[model samples]
Target: MYIHSTDVNRTLQSAISNLIGMYYNSTAAKPGIDYPEIPEWPHGYVPIPLHTVIRKTDFVRLLTFVLNAYELKKKNVAGKLMFPC
Candidate 1:
């Protein structure tokens, strides 16, 4: 499967988690079963490659962020950004 994300670290990690959930094969998790023999590899762990464009070239994402910041500034809301767990 092909996986792609924004160059941002959070997006990269989120893509990796999705790949693990979607593609890992438990039946072939053992050494010499589906890949090179590596004792250290975790069971059912598949190395999935993530593709991303450089930040400067990721125009769509950059534009969205810039627009959001501009809107926030226009609103003039004085508050720290927050997320609830």
Candidate 2:
């Protein structure tokens, strides 16, 4: 998978805001955090999971897990093709 780390901060802020909105109120007052509006996708919606096991509560960590899984799958495919003796 093509993972882009661009705008990691902005993306993280947006994700937190959306989570807060979904859990609490749209205009909920969450101190010690910046609540920015999430970017809209042009086509079909991309879903974000509400619950996470990793308690970092940020986008980069979550995205890293997803990207790593994709990379691992790609590597596995390459390994299988090369060792098909």
Candidate 3:
């Protein structure tokens, strides 16, 4: 599966928020250390499960693509700034 990290993170965040909301609504209890009090606001980094590990080749490819895209965007922005229309 060729999944982007940003997309995966977003989906995970949404699922976690939904699950937390469901748990709180069903039990009518405040969240503890296991869960954040505000599901919408992130407290820290979310840990990825071991089952959903990414391949080394895939990770390298993704990193290369991201870096190249960032560089291209930076150059484009700089060019536009240097030569305004």
What TM-score quantifies how close candidate 2 is to the native fold? 0.25
Each model's TM-score? 0.62, 0.25, 0.26
| Structure candidate 2, residue pairs in collision | none
For residues 1-85, write the lDDT of model 3, one tens digit per residue. 2323333566557755655454444343335543466768454323333223354545655777778777776788546543222
Q: Quantify all predictions' global Cα lDDT against the true fold.
A: 0.75, 0.49, 0.50
The segments of candidate 2 whose C-alpha lies over 4 angstroms from its true place after superposition are 1-56, 78-85
Cα-lDDT of candidate 1: 0.75
Stretches of candidate 1 off by over 4 Å are 28-33, 66-85
Please tell me which predicted candidate would have the highest lDDT against the true structure: 1
lDDT of 2 by residue, 21-85 (tens): 55554344333343433455212233344333334565767677778777776788646543211
Question: For residues 10-72, what per-residue lDDT tens digits would candidate 1 score against the true structure?
Answer: 988898888888888978676665556677867667687788999889876888888887777
Clashes of 2: 0
